[model samples]
Target: MSLTEIRSRIAKACDAAGRDPGEVTLIAVSKMQPDHRVRAVLEEGQRVFGENRVQEAAGKWPGFREDFGAVELHIIGPLQTNKARQAMELAQAIHSLDRPKLATTLARLADEIGTCPDLFIQVNTGEEPQKAGILPSEVDSFVAEVRGLGLPLKGLMCIPPVDETPSLHFALLAKFADRNGLAGLSMGMSGDFEEAIALGATHVRVGSAIFGTRP
Candidate 1:
Protein backbone atom coordinates (compact mmCIF):
# COMPACT_ATOMS: atom_id res chain seq x y z
CA MET A 1 0.00 0.00 0.00
CA SER A 2 1.05 3.56 -0.62
CA LEU A 3 1.48 6.19 2.06
CA THR A 4 -1.71 7.89 1.00
CA GLU A 5 -3.67 4.65 1.33
CA ILE A 6 -2.32 3.92 4.77
CA ARG A 7 -3.13 7.45 5.84
CA SER A 8 -6.61 7.06 4.45
CA ARG A 9 -7.06 3.98 6.56
CA ILE A 10 -5.90 5.88 9.61
CA ALA A 11 -8.36 8.66 8.87
CA LYS A 12 -11.14 6.16 8.40
CA ALA A 13 -10.24 4.52 11.63
CA CYS A 14 -10.32 7.83 13.43
CA ASP A 15 -13.62 8.76 11.87
CA ALA A 16 -15.15 5.47 12.91
CA ALA A 17 -13.88 6.09 16.40
CA GLY A 18 -15.17 9.69 16.53
CA ARG A 19 -11.71 11.10 16.72
CA ASP A 20 -10.12 13.85 14.72
CA PRO A 21 -7.72 12.29 12.22
CA GLY A 22 -5.15 14.85 13.26
CA GLU A 23 -4.91 13.21 16.67
CA VAL A 24 -3.34 10.08 15.18
CA THR A 25 0.34 10.28 14.36
CA LEU A 26 1.30 7.74 11.73
CA ILE A 27 4.88 6.59 12.19
CA ALA A 28 6.25 5.09 9.01
CA VAL A 29 8.56 2.33 10.34
CA SER A 30 11.51 2.41 8.01
CA LYS A 31 13.66 -0.09 9.81
CA MET A 32 15.52 -2.55 7.53
CA GLN A 33 14.03 -0.87 4.46
CA PRO A 34 16.06 0.29 1.47
CA ASP A 35 16.94 3.97 1.13
CA HIS A 36 14.93 4.37 -2.04
CA ARG A 37 11.81 3.11 -0.34
CA VAL A 38 12.29 5.53 2.54
CA ARG A 39 12.91 8.44 0.20
CA ALA A 40 9.79 7.59 -1.71
CA VAL A 41 7.75 7.98 1.47
CA LEU A 42 9.65 11.12 2.36
CA GLU A 43 8.77 12.56 -1.02
CA GLU A 44 5.15 11.91 -0.20
CA GLY A 45 5.61 14.35 2.73
CA GLN A 46 5.82 11.84 5.50
CA ARG A 47 7.91 13.57 8.13
CA VAL A 48 7.48 11.10 11.00
CA PHE A 49 9.45 7.85 10.77
CA GLY A 50 10.38 5.09 13.24
CA GLU A 51 13.68 3.25 13.34
CA ASN A 52 14.64 0.20 15.38
CA ARG A 53 18.27 0.92 16.08
CA VAL A 54 20.28 3.96 17.12
CA GLN A 55 23.24 3.22 14.84
CA GLU A 56 21.10 2.63 11.75
CA ALA A 57 18.97 5.71 12.47
CA ALA A 58 22.06 7.80 13.14
CA GLY A 59 23.47 6.69 9.80
CA LYS A 60 20.25 7.22 7.87
CA TRP A 61 18.43 10.30 9.26
CA PRO A 62 21.19 12.91 9.32
CA GLY A 63 21.38 12.81 5.54
CA PHE A 64 17.63 12.65 5.19
CA ARG A 65 17.20 15.71 7.42
CA GLU A 66 19.73 17.54 5.26
CA ASP A 67 17.70 16.78 2.15
CA PHE A 68 14.16 16.91 3.53
CA GLY A 69 14.68 19.94 5.81
CA ALA A 70 13.01 18.40 8.89
CA VAL A 71 11.92 14.96 10.01
CA GLU A 72 10.62 13.35 13.20
CA LEU A 73 12.61 10.25 14.07
CA HIS A 74 11.27 7.83 16.68
CA ILE A 75 13.42 5.11 18.19
CA ILE A 76 10.97 2.23 18.40
CA GLY A 77 13.21 -0.68 19.30
CA PRO A 78 14.63 -1.95 22.59
CA LEU A 79 17.44 0.38 23.60
CA GLN A 80 20.62 -0.58 25.36
CA THR A 81 21.52 1.64 28.31
CA ASN A 82 24.75 2.76 26.59
CA LYS A 83 22.88 3.87 23.47
CA ALA A 84 20.50 6.23 25.30
CA ARG A 85 22.51 9.35 24.57
CA GLN A 86 22.92 8.56 20.91
CA ALA A 87 19.23 7.73 20.56
CA MET A 88 18.28 10.93 22.37
CA GLU A 89 20.39 12.95 19.95
CA LEU A 90 18.90 11.25 16.90
CA ALA A 91 15.19 10.91 17.60
CA GLN A 92 12.37 13.11 18.81
CA ALA A 93 10.70 10.22 20.64
CA ILE A 94 11.75 6.97 22.31
CA HIS A 95 9.06 4.29 22.39
CA SER A 96 10.84 1.52 24.22
CA LEU A 97 11.62 2.87 27.68
CA ASP A 98 11.25 -0.53 29.35
CA ARG A 99 13.53 -0.95 32.34
CA PRO A 100 14.82 0.81 35.46
CA LYS A 101 18.50 0.61 34.58
CA LEU A 102 17.70 2.29 31.28
CA ALA A 103 15.37 4.73 33.04
CA THR A 104 18.12 5.76 35.46
CA THR A 105 20.49 6.12 32.50
CA LEU A 106 18.00 8.32 30.67
CA ALA A 107 17.35 10.46 33.74
CA ARG A 108 21.06 11.03 34.27
CA LEU A 109 21.57 11.84 30.61
CA ALA A 110 18.58 14.14 30.60
CA ASP A 111 19.96 15.99 33.61
CA GLU A 112 23.34 16.38 31.96
CA ILE A 113 22.03 17.45 28.56
CA GLY A 114 19.11 19.49 30.03
CA THR A 115 16.74 17.94 27.52
CA CYS A 116 15.22 14.56 26.76
CA PRO A 117 13.20 13.19 23.94
CA ASP A 118 9.57 12.27 24.45
CA LEU A 119 9.45 8.90 26.21
CA PHE A 120 6.86 6.14 26.19
CA ILE A 121 7.17 3.42 28.80
CA GLN A 122 7.06 0.06 27.07
CA VAL A 123 4.88 -2.38 28.95
CA ASN A 124 5.01 -6.11 28.24
CA THR A 125 1.25 -6.47 28.18
CA GLY A 126 1.47 -10.16 27.49
CA GLU A 127 4.13 -10.63 30.19
CA GLU A 128 6.22 -12.66 27.76
CA PRO A 129 9.61 -13.53 29.26
CA GLN A 130 11.46 -12.77 26.05
CA LYS A 131 9.87 -9.34 25.60
CA ALA A 132 11.55 -6.14 26.72
CA GLY A 133 9.03 -4.20 28.83
CA ILE A 134 7.77 -3.65 32.36
CA LEU A 135 5.47 -6.46 33.37
CA PRO A 136 1.80 -5.59 34.00
CA SER A 137 2.24 -5.53 37.77
CA GLU A 138 5.18 -3.13 37.67
CA VAL A 139 3.71 -0.30 35.58
CA ASP A 140 2.39 1.89 38.43
CA SER A 141 5.62 1.97 40.37
CA PHE A 142 7.62 2.33 37.17
CA VAL A 143 5.54 5.29 36.10
CA ALA A 144 6.14 7.00 39.42
CA GLU A 145 9.86 6.33 39.19
CA VAL A 146 10.10 7.68 35.65
CA ARG A 147 8.02 10.71 36.57
CA GLY A 148 10.15 11.45 39.62
CA LEU A 149 13.21 11.63 37.40
CA GLY A 150 11.62 14.56 35.52
CA LEU A 151 11.83 12.78 32.16
CA PRO A 152 9.50 13.86 29.40
CA LEU A 153 7.15 10.94 29.67
CA LYS A 154 4.66 11.15 26.82
CA GLY A 155 2.80 7.86 27.25
CA LEU A 156 2.88 4.08 27.30
CA MET A 157 3.80 1.46 24.65
CA CYS A 158 3.20 -2.25 24.26
CA ILE A 159 3.72 -5.12 21.81
CA PRO A 160 1.05 -7.73 22.29
CA PRO A 161 1.82 -11.41 21.82
CA VAL A 162 1.37 -12.08 18.11
CA ASP A 163 -0.81 -15.15 18.57
CA GLU A 164 -3.39 -13.20 20.61
CA THR A 165 -5.82 -10.56 19.41
CA PRO A 166 -4.20 -7.13 19.22
CA SER A 167 -7.18 -5.23 20.62
CA LEU A 168 -6.89 -7.00 23.94
CA HIS A 169 -3.41 -5.56 24.32
CA PHE A 170 -4.42 -2.19 22.98
CA ALA A 171 -7.24 -2.12 25.51
CA LEU A 172 -4.86 -3.16 28.23
CA LEU A 173 -2.46 -0.35 27.36
CA ALA A 174 -5.40 2.04 27.24
CA LYS A 175 -6.31 1.07 30.78
CA PHE A 176 -2.85 1.96 32.01
CA ALA A 177 -2.62 5.17 30.00
CA ASP A 178 -6.03 6.26 31.22
CA ARG A 179 -5.02 5.60 34.79
CA ASN A 180 -2.01 7.84 34.35
CA GLY A 181 -3.79 10.38 32.17
CA LEU A 182 -1.06 9.83 29.57
CA ALA A 183 -1.78 11.61 26.35
CA GLY A 184 0.00 9.24 24.02
CA LEU A 185 -0.83 5.58 23.65
CA SER A 186 1.72 4.16 21.24
CA MET A 187 0.18 0.89 20.22
CA GLY A 188 -0.88 -0.80 17.00
CA MET A 189 1.09 -1.69 13.88
CA SER A 190 0.46 -2.44 10.23
CA GLY A 191 -1.98 -5.28 10.79
CA ASP A 192 -4.18 -3.94 13.58
CA PHE A 193 -3.86 -0.17 13.58
CA GLU A 194 -7.54 0.50 12.94
CA GLU A 195 -8.52 -1.48 15.98
CA ALA A 196 -5.81 0.41 17.83
CA ILE A 197 -7.20 3.78 16.80
CA ALA A 198 -10.56 2.59 18.02
CA LEU A 199 -9.07 1.75 21.38
CA GLY A 200 -7.39 5.20 21.67
CA ALA A 201 -4.00 4.75 20.07
CA THR A 202 -2.46 8.17 19.58
CA HIS A 203 0.45 6.75 17.63
CA VAL A 204 0.37 3.81 15.23
CA ARG A 205 3.56 2.27 13.83
CA VAL A 206 2.76 1.15 10.30
CA GLY A 207 5.59 -0.28 8.23
CA SER A 208 5.09 -2.84 5.44
CA ALA A 209 1.64 -1.53 4.66
CA ILE A 210 3.21 1.78 3.71
CA PHE A 211 6.75 0.86 2.62
CA GLY A 212 6.17 -2.60 1.16
CA THR A 213 8.04 -5.72 2.30
CA ARG A 214 11.46 -5.12 3.71
CA PRO A 215 14.64 -6.61 2.26
Candidate 2:
Protein backbone atom coordinates (compact mmCIF):
# COMPACT_ATOMS: atom_id res chain seq x y z
CA MET A 1 0.00 0.00 0.00
CA SER A 2 3.05 2.24 0.32
CA LEU A 3 6.19 2.79 -1.73
CA THR A 4 8.48 1.43 0.94
CA GLU A 5 6.30 -1.62 1.38
CA ILE A 6 6.17 -2.28 -2.38
CA ARG A 7 9.94 -1.88 -2.49
CA SER A 8 10.37 -4.25 0.41
CA ARG A 9 8.13 -6.72 -1.40
CA ILE A 10 10.22 -6.31 -4.53
CA ALA A 11 13.31 -7.12 -2.52
CA LYS A 12 11.66 -10.19 -1.11
CA ALA A 13 10.62 -11.25 -4.59
CA CYS A 14 14.11 -10.75 -5.90
CA ASP A 15 15.57 -12.56 -2.93
CA ALA A 16 13.22 -15.42 -3.70
CA ALA A 17 14.24 -15.32 -7.35
CA GLY A 18 17.96 -15.02 -6.59
CA ARG A 19 17.99 -11.66 -8.38
CA ASP A 20 19.42 -8.38 -7.23
CA PRO A 21 16.63 -5.89 -6.45
CA GLY A 22 18.47 -3.41 -8.65
CA GLU A 23 17.81 -5.63 -11.66
CA VAL A 24 14.11 -4.87 -11.58
CA THR A 25 13.07 -1.26 -12.02
CA LEU A 26 9.75 -0.46 -10.34
CA ILE A 27 7.68 1.96 -12.42
CA ALA A 28 5.21 3.89 -10.32
CA VAL A 29 2.24 4.08 -12.65
CA SER A 30 1.17 7.68 -12.36
CA LYS A 31 -1.48 7.85 -14.98
CA MET A 32 -4.49 9.88 -13.78
CA GLN A 33 -2.93 10.32 -10.34
CA PRO A 34 -3.46 13.71 -8.72
CA ASP A 35 -0.39 15.94 -8.65
CA HIS A 36 -0.23 15.89 -4.86
CA ARG A 37 -0.01 12.12 -4.79
CA VAL A 38 2.64 12.11 -7.51
CA ARG A 39 4.66 14.73 -5.66
CA ALA A 40 4.47 12.65 -2.53
CA VAL A 41 5.96 9.69 -4.34
CA LEU A 42 8.65 11.88 -5.84
CA GLU A 43 9.43 13.24 -2.41
CA GLU A 44 9.80 9.69 -1.21
CA GLY A 45 12.57 9.09 -3.80
CA GLN A 46 10.61 7.45 -6.59
CA ARG A 47 11.99 8.86 -9.85
CA VAL A 48 10.75 6.19 -12.25
CA PHE A 49 7.10 6.46 -13.32
CA GLY A 50 4.78 5.17 -16.04
CA GLU A 51 2.17 7.19 -17.94
CA ASN A 52 -0.45 5.94 -20.36
CA ARG A 53 -0.84 9.07 -22.43
CA VAL A 54 1.63 11.44 -24.06
CA GLN A 55 -0.57 14.51 -23.73
CA GLU A 56 -1.08 13.97 -20.01
CA ALA A 57 2.60 13.27 -19.48
CA ALA A 58 3.49 16.40 -21.43
CA GLY A 59 1.25 18.49 -19.24
CA LYS A 60 2.26 16.86 -15.95
CA TRP A 61 5.93 15.82 -16.10
CA PRO A 62 7.50 19.06 -17.29
CA GLY A 63 6.53 20.77 -14.06
CA PHE A 64 7.50 17.70 -12.03
CA ARG A 65 10.88 17.53 -13.77
CA GLU A 66 11.49 21.15 -12.95
CA ASP A 67 10.73 20.43 -9.30
CA PHE A 68 12.21 16.92 -8.98
CA GLY A 69 15.20 17.42 -11.32
CA ALA A 70 15.36 13.85 -12.66
CA VAL A 71 12.46 11.54 -13.58
CA GLU A 72 12.42 8.45 -15.76
CA LEU A 73 9.18 8.14 -17.68
CA HIS A 74 7.86 5.07 -19.50
CA ILE A 75 4.94 5.31 -21.90
CA ILE A 76 3.04 2.13 -21.11
CA GLY A 77 -0.10 2.56 -23.18
CA PRO A 78 -1.29 2.35 -26.78
CA LEU A 79 0.63 4.86 -28.92
CA GLN A 80 -0.96 6.47 -31.87
CA THR A 81 1.35 7.20 -34.82
CA ASN A 82 0.67 10.93 -34.51
CA LYS A 83 1.77 10.97 -30.91
CA ALA A 84 5.04 9.07 -31.47
CA ARG A 85 7.22 12.17 -31.54
CA GLN A 86 5.78 13.60 -28.34
CA ALA A 87 6.07 10.24 -26.59
CA MET A 88 9.71 9.92 -27.65
CA GLU A 89 10.49 13.37 -26.28
CA LEU A 90 8.86 12.64 -22.94
CA ALA A 91 9.65 9.01 -22.13
CA GLN A 92 12.97 7.34 -21.54
CA ALA A 93 11.46 4.05 -22.58
CA ILE A 94 8.19 2.96 -24.18
CA HIS A 95 6.49 -0.34 -23.37
CA SER A 96 3.93 -0.27 -26.16
CA LEU A 97 5.75 -0.56 -29.46
CA ASP A 98 3.16 -2.93 -30.85
CA ARG A 99 2.71 -2.03 -34.50
CA PRO A 100 4.82 -1.57 -37.61
CA LYS A 101 3.39 1.84 -38.48
CA LEU A 102 4.38 3.14 -35.06
CA ALA A 103 7.82 1.59 -35.47
CA THR A 104 8.32 3.22 -38.85
CA THR A 105 7.17 6.53 -37.44
CA LEU A 106 9.62 6.19 -34.58
CA ALA A 107 12.41 5.30 -36.98
CA ARG A 108 11.76 8.38 -39.05
CA LEU A 109 11.70 10.60 -35.99
CA ALA A 110 14.84 8.99 -34.61
CA ASP A 111 16.62 9.82 -37.83
CA GLU A 112 15.40 13.39 -37.68
CA ILE A 113 16.19 13.93 -34.00
CA GLY A 114 19.24 11.61 -33.74
CA THR A 115 17.80 9.84 -30.70
CA CYS A 116 15.02 7.46 -29.76
CA PRO A 117 13.62 6.07 -26.59
CA ASP A 118 14.27 2.43 -25.65
CA LEU A 119 11.34 0.31 -26.86
CA PHE A 120 9.49 -2.79 -25.72
CA ILE A 121 7.40 -4.75 -28.18
CA GLN A 122 4.00 -5.55 -26.77
CA VAL A 123 3.02 -9.13 -27.55
CA ASN A 124 -0.56 -10.30 -27.13
CA THR A 125 0.38 -13.59 -25.57
CA GLY A 126 -3.25 -14.30 -24.79
CA GLU A 127 -4.25 -13.71 -28.42
CA GLU A 128 -6.95 -11.25 -27.41
CA PRO A 129 -8.20 -9.54 -30.55
CA GLN A 130 -9.18 -6.38 -28.71
CA LYS A 131 -5.70 -5.91 -27.27
CA ALA A 132 -3.05 -3.79 -28.96
CA GLY A 133 -0.03 -6.06 -29.35
CA ILE A 134 1.68 -8.24 -31.87
CA LEU A 135 0.35 -11.77 -32.01
CA PRO A 136 2.41 -14.49 -30.32
CA SER A 137 2.89 -16.07 -33.74
CA GLU A 138 3.86 -12.74 -35.33
CA VAL A 139 6.34 -11.51 -32.70
CA ASP A 140 9.42 -13.08 -34.24
CA SER A 141 8.83 -11.39 -37.56
CA PHE A 142 7.85 -8.12 -35.90
CA VAL A 143 11.07 -8.10 -33.89
CA ALA A 144 13.02 -8.66 -37.08
CA GLU A 145 11.14 -5.85 -38.76
CA VAL A 146 11.62 -3.36 -35.92
CA ARG A 147 15.31 -4.24 -35.72
CA GLY A 148 15.67 -3.85 -39.46
CA LEU A 149 14.42 -0.26 -39.14
CA GLY A 150 17.29 0.43 -36.71
CA LEU A 151 14.92 1.36 -33.89
CA PRO A 152 16.33 0.66 -30.46
CA LEU A 153 14.40 -2.47 -29.48
CA LYS A 154 15.10 -3.20 -25.81
CA GLY A 155 12.75 -6.17 -25.17
CA LEU A 156 9.16 -7.32 -25.02
CA MET A 157 6.01 -6.45 -22.98
CA CYS A 158 2.67 -8.11 -22.31
CA ILE A 159 -0.52 -7.87 -20.23
CA PRO A 160 -2.08 -11.30 -19.94
CA PRO A 161 -5.83 -11.75 -20.01
CA VAL A 162 -7.28 -10.96 -16.59
CA ASP A 163 -8.82 -14.43 -16.22
CA GLU A 164 -5.73 -16.32 -17.42
CA THR A 165 -2.60 -17.15 -15.47
CA PRO A 166 -0.15 -14.23 -15.79
CA SER A 167 3.03 -16.20 -15.23
CA LEU A 168 2.28 -18.32 -18.27
CA HIS A 169 2.30 -15.20 -20.47
CA PHE A 170 5.29 -13.71 -18.68
CA ALA A 171 7.29 -16.87 -19.33
CA LEU A 172 6.27 -16.82 -22.97
CA LEU A 173 7.39 -13.19 -23.30
CA ALA A 174 10.73 -14.06 -21.70
CA LYS A 175 11.23 -16.80 -24.29
CA PHE A 176 10.63 -14.38 -27.16
CA ALA A 177 13.08 -11.81 -25.80
CA ASP A 178 15.71 -14.48 -25.07
CA ARG A 179 15.65 -15.93 -28.57
CA ASN A 180 16.03 -12.45 -30.05
CA GLY A 181 18.85 -11.60 -27.61
CA LEU A 182 16.84 -8.75 -26.15
CA ALA A 183 17.23 -8.06 -22.44
CA GLY A 184 14.24 -6.11 -21.11
CA LEU A 185 11.02 -7.84 -20.04
CA SER A 186 8.31 -5.28 -19.20
CA MET A 187 5.81 -7.60 -17.63
CA GLY A 188 4.09 -7.81 -14.25
CA MET A 189 1.96 -5.40 -12.27
CA SER A 190 0.92 -4.88 -8.65
CA GLY A 191 -0.37 -8.43 -8.19
CA ASP A 192 2.02 -10.80 -9.97
CA PHE A 193 5.35 -8.99 -10.16
CA GLU A 194 7.05 -11.49 -7.90
CA GLU A 195 6.17 -14.27 -10.29
CA ALA A 196 7.35 -12.06 -13.15
CA ILE A 197 10.67 -11.42 -11.46
CA ALA A 198 11.02 -15.15 -10.95
CA LEU A 199 10.53 -15.56 -14.68
CA GLY A 200 12.99 -12.71 -15.42
CA ALA A 201 11.10 -9.42 -15.63
CA THR A 202 13.44 -6.46 -15.90
CA HIS A 203 10.69 -3.95 -15.13
CA VAL A 204 7.41 -4.16 -13.26
CA ARG A 205 4.74 -1.47 -13.56
CA VAL A 206 2.89 -0.82 -10.30
CA GLY A 207 -0.04 1.52 -9.92
CA SER A 208 -2.73 1.63 -7.18
CA ALA A 209 -0.36 -0.05 -4.74
CA ILE A 210 2.03 2.88 -4.83
CA PHE A 211 -0.32 5.80 -5.48
CA GLY A 212 -3.44 4.30 -3.89
CA THR A 213 -6.61 3.87 -5.94
CA ARG A 214 -7.58 6.57 -8.44
CA PRO A 215 -10.86 8.44 -8.06
Candidate 3:
Protein backbone atom coordinates (compact mmCIF):
# COMPACT_ATOMS: atom_id res chain seq x y z
CA MET A 1 0.00 0.00 0.00
CA SER A 2 1.09 3.54 -0.64
CA LEU A 3 1.58 6.13 2.07
CA THR A 4 -1.42 8.10 0.84
CA GLU A 5 -3.61 5.04 1.07
CA ILE A 6 -2.47 4.31 4.61
CA ARG A 7 -3.07 7.94 5.65
CA SER A 8 -6.51 7.78 4.08
CA ARG A 9 -7.26 4.66 6.06
CA ILE A 10 -6.08 6.30 9.27
CA ALA A 11 -8.30 9.30 8.51
CA LYS A 12 -11.26 7.06 7.96
CA ALA A 13 -10.56 5.19 11.16
CA CYS A 14 -10.27 8.45 13.08
CA ASP A 15 -13.47 9.73 11.55
CA ALA A 16 -15.28 6.55 12.46
CA ALA A 17 -13.94 6.74 15.98
CA GLY A 18 -15.00 10.38 16.42
CA ARG A 19 -11.39 11.36 16.83
CA ASP A 20 -9.19 14.10 15.45
CA PRO A 21 -6.87 12.47 12.93
CA GLY A 22 -4.07 14.67 14.18
CA GLU A 23 -4.18 12.96 17.54
CA VAL A 24 -2.80 9.67 16.24
CA THR A 25 0.77 9.47 15.02
CA LEU A 26 1.51 6.94 12.29
CA ILE A 27 4.91 5.25 12.54
CA ALA A 28 6.03 3.45 9.41
CA VAL A 29 7.72 0.21 10.58
CA SER A 30 10.80 0.31 8.42
CA LYS A 31 12.69 -2.69 9.75
CA MET A 32 13.81 -5.14 7.04
CA GLN A 33 12.87 -2.71 4.30
CA PRO A 34 15.66 -1.64 1.97
CA ASP A 35 16.99 1.89 2.00
CA HIS A 36 15.40 2.63 -1.36
CA ARG A 37 11.98 1.73 -0.03
CA VAL A 38 12.61 3.84 3.03
CA ARG A 39 13.65 6.70 0.79
CA ALA A 40 10.45 6.21 -1.15
CA VAL A 41 8.42 6.61 2.02
CA LEU A 42 10.53 9.63 2.92
CA GLU A 43 9.69 11.05 -0.47
CA GLU A 44 6.07 10.62 0.43
CA GLY A 45 6.63 13.00 3.37
CA GLN A 46 6.71 10.45 6.16
CA ARG A 47 9.00 11.74 8.89
CA VAL A 48 8.28 9.23 11.67
CA PHE A 49 9.41 5.58 11.42
CA GLY A 50 9.83 2.50 13.66
CA GLU A 51 12.91 0.31 13.46
CA ASN A 52 13.14 -3.04 15.31
CA ARG A 53 16.88 -3.41 15.71
CA VAL A 54 19.65 -1.05 16.76
CA GLN A 55 22.18 -2.73 14.52
CA GLU A 56 20.00 -2.64 11.39
CA ALA A 57 19.02 0.94 12.05
CA ALA A 58 22.59 1.87 12.78
CA GLY A 59 23.62 0.49 9.42
CA LYS A 60 20.82 2.07 7.40
CA TRP A 61 19.70 5.37 8.94
CA PRO A 62 22.74 7.63 9.25
CA GLY A 63 23.03 8.28 5.53
CA PHE A 64 19.27 8.49 5.17
CA ARG A 65 19.13 11.02 7.99
CA GLU A 66 21.90 13.00 6.36
CA ASP A 67 19.70 13.36 3.30
CA PHE A 68 16.38 13.52 5.14
CA GLY A 69 17.40 15.50 8.15
CA ALA A 70 14.06 15.65 9.92
CA VAL A 71 13.33 11.95 10.25
CA GLU A 72 12.24 10.58 13.59
CA LEU A 73 13.45 7.07 14.38
CA HIS A 74 11.86 4.89 17.08
CA ILE A 75 13.33 1.71 18.51
CA ILE A 76 10.45 -0.80 18.63
CA GLY A 77 12.01 -4.12 19.49
CA PRO A 78 13.47 -5.85 22.58
CA LEU A 79 16.32 -3.59 23.72
CA GLN A 80 19.44 -5.06 25.27
CA THR A 81 20.86 -3.21 28.25
CA ASN A 82 24.30 -2.93 26.69
CA LYS A 83 22.77 -1.23 23.63
CA ALA A 84 20.86 1.37 25.60
CA ARG A 85 23.41 4.10 25.00
CA GLN A 86 23.53 3.42 21.28
CA ALA A 87 19.76 3.33 21.16
CA MET A 88 19.65 6.64 23.02
CA GLU A 89 21.96 8.20 20.48
CA LEU A 90 20.14 6.80 17.45
CA ALA A 91 16.45 6.83 18.33
CA GLN A 92 14.06 9.63 19.12
CA ALA A 93 11.85 7.22 21.10
CA ILE A 94 11.99 3.63 22.35
CA HIS A 95 8.96 1.36 22.66
CA SER A 96 10.35 -1.72 24.42
CA LEU A 97 11.42 -0.71 27.91
CA ASP A 98 10.18 -3.72 29.93
CA ARG A 99 12.70 -4.36 32.68
CA PRO A 100 14.56 -2.69 35.53
CA LYS A 101 18.06 -3.30 34.21
CA LEU A 102 17.29 -1.68 30.85
CA ALA A 103 15.50 1.14 32.61
CA THR A 104 18.44 1.68 34.96
CA THR A 105 20.89 1.74 32.11
CA LEU A 106 18.74 4.18 30.17
CA ALA A 107 18.31 6.46 33.16
CA ARG A 108 22.05 6.45 33.90
CA LEU A 109 22.92 7.11 30.29
CA ALA A 110 20.34 9.84 29.99
CA ASP A 111 21.77 11.53 33.08
CA GLU A 112 25.24 11.32 31.66
CA ILE A 113 24.35 12.41 28.13
CA GLY A 114 21.62 14.89 29.06
CA THR A 115 19.32 13.34 26.46
CA CYS A 116 16.61 10.75 26.84
CA PRO A 117 14.22 9.80 24.13
CA ASP A 118 10.58 9.21 24.88
CA LEU A 119 10.15 5.92 26.80
CA PHE A 120 7.31 3.43 26.67
CA ILE A 121 6.96 0.54 29.07
CA GLN A 122 6.07 -2.53 27.09
CA VAL A 123 3.34 -4.58 28.79
CA ASN A 124 2.93 -8.28 28.20
CA THR A 125 -0.79 -7.88 28.29
CA GLY A 126 -1.40 -11.34 26.93
CA GLU A 127 0.97 -12.95 29.40
CA GLU A 128 2.64 -14.67 26.50
CA PRO A 129 5.59 -16.70 27.70
CA GLN A 130 8.06 -15.64 25.04
CA LYS A 131 7.18 -11.99 24.70
CA ALA A 132 9.56 -9.23 25.81
CA GLY A 133 7.34 -6.99 27.96
CA ILE A 134 6.63 -6.77 31.63
CA LEU A 135 3.54 -8.54 32.94
CA PRO A 136 0.49 -6.30 33.37
CA SER A 137 0.69 -6.55 37.15
CA GLU A 138 4.24 -5.25 37.14
CA VAL A 139 3.49 -1.99 35.31
CA ASP A 140 2.79 0.27 38.27
CA SER A 141 5.89 -0.60 40.23
CA PHE A 142 8.08 -0.48 37.14
CA VAL A 143 6.68 2.87 36.11
CA ALA A 144 7.35 4.21 39.57
CA GLU A 145 10.87 2.79 39.57
CA VAL A 146 11.68 4.23 36.18
CA ARG A 147 10.25 7.57 37.28
CA GLY A 148 12.40 7.54 40.41
CA LEU A 149 15.38 7.04 38.16
CA GLY A 150 14.32 10.09 36.11
CA LEU A 151 13.75 8.18 32.89
CA PRO A 152 11.35 9.80 30.48
CA LEU A 153 8.20 7.74 30.96
CA LYS A 154 5.92 8.86 28.18
CA GLY A 155 3.45 5.91 28.11
CA LEU A 156 2.87 2.21 27.53
CA MET A 157 3.14 -0.22 24.59
CA CYS A 158 1.88 -3.78 23.93
CA ILE A 159 1.47 -6.37 21.22
CA PRO A 160 -1.67 -8.40 21.78
CA PRO A 161 -1.61 -12.10 21.06
CA VAL A 162 -2.23 -12.66 17.38
CA ASP A 163 -4.94 -15.20 17.99
CA GLU A 164 -6.90 -13.18 20.52
CA THR A 165 -9.08 -10.11 20.12
CA PRO A 166 -6.72 -7.13 20.01
CA SER A 167 -9.30 -4.72 21.38
CA LEU A 168 -9.23 -6.49 24.69
CA HIS A 169 -5.51 -5.89 25.05
CA PHE A 170 -5.69 -2.39 23.63
CA ALA A 171 -8.42 -1.51 26.10
CA LEU A 172 -6.38 -2.99 28.91
CA LEU A 173 -3.35 -0.91 27.92
CA ALA A 174 -5.47 2.24 27.68
CA LYS A 175 -6.90 1.60 31.10
CA PHE A 176 -3.44 1.06 32.55
CA ALA A 177 -2.16 4.28 31.01
CA ASP A 178 -5.15 6.21 32.32
CA ARG A 179 -4.77 4.84 35.83
CA ASN A 180 -1.05 5.64 35.76
CA GLY A 181 -1.44 9.14 34.27
CA LEU A 182 0.25 8.17 31.03
CA ALA A 183 -0.93 9.73 27.80
CA GLY A 184 0.84 7.73 25.14
CA LEU A 185 -0.42 4.27 24.18
CA SER A 186 1.55 2.56 21.41
CA MET A 187 -0.58 -0.39 20.44
CA GLY A 188 -2.00 -1.74 17.21
CA MET A 189 -0.47 -2.76 13.94
CA SER A 190 -1.70 -2.71 10.35
CA GLY A 191 -4.47 -5.22 10.99
CA ASP A 192 -6.21 -3.68 13.98
CA PHE A 193 -5.14 -0.05 14.00
CA GLU A 194 -8.67 1.20 13.41
CA GLU A 195 -9.83 -0.59 16.53
CA ALA A 196 -6.85 0.80 18.39
CA ILE A 197 -7.71 4.32 17.27
CA ALA A 198 -11.21 3.91 18.58
CA LEU A 199 -9.75 2.88 21.93
CA GLY A 200 -7.33 5.87 22.07
CA ALA A 201 -4.00 4.87 20.61
CA THR A 202 -1.51 7.72 20.52
CA HIS A 203 0.63 5.87 18.01
CA VAL A 204 0.18 2.95 15.59
CA ARG A 205 3.07 1.02 14.03
CA VAL A 206 2.26 -0.21 10.54
CA GLY A 207 4.64 -2.32 8.46
CA SER A 208 3.48 -4.94 5.93
CA ALA A 209 0.41 -3.00 4.92
CA ILE A 210 2.59 -0.13 3.81
CA PHE A 211 5.83 -1.77 2.71
CA GLY A 212 4.52 -5.24 1.83
CA THR A 213 5.51 -8.52 3.49
CA ARG A 214 8.98 -8.86 4.90
CA PRO A 215 11.19 -11.65 3.56
Q: Give the best candidate by lDDT.
A: 2
64-138: candidate 3 lDDT, tens digit per residue? 989988789999999999888999999999999999989889988998999999999999999999999999999
Model 2 agreement with the true structure over 1-215: per-residue lDDT tens digits: 99999999999999999999999999999999999999999999999999999999999999999999989999999999999999999999999999899999999999998999999999999999899999999999999999999989999999999999999999999999999999999999989988999999999999999999897
- Candidate 3's C-alpha runs over 4 A off are none
Indicate the residue-level lDDT of 47 in model 3: 95
- The candidate, 1 or 3, that scores higher on lDDT is 1
Error of 2 at 88 (Å): 0.8
Over 4 Å off, model 2:
none
lDDT of 2 at 1: 91
Query: Which portions of model 1 show Cα errors greater than 4 Å?
Result: none
What RMSD, rounded to one decimal, does every model reach? 0.6, 0.6, 0.7
**Angstrom error at residue 31, model 2:** 0.3
- Please tell me which model should have the higher lDDT, number 1 or number 2: 2
Query: What's the lDDT for residue 60 in model 2?
Result: 100
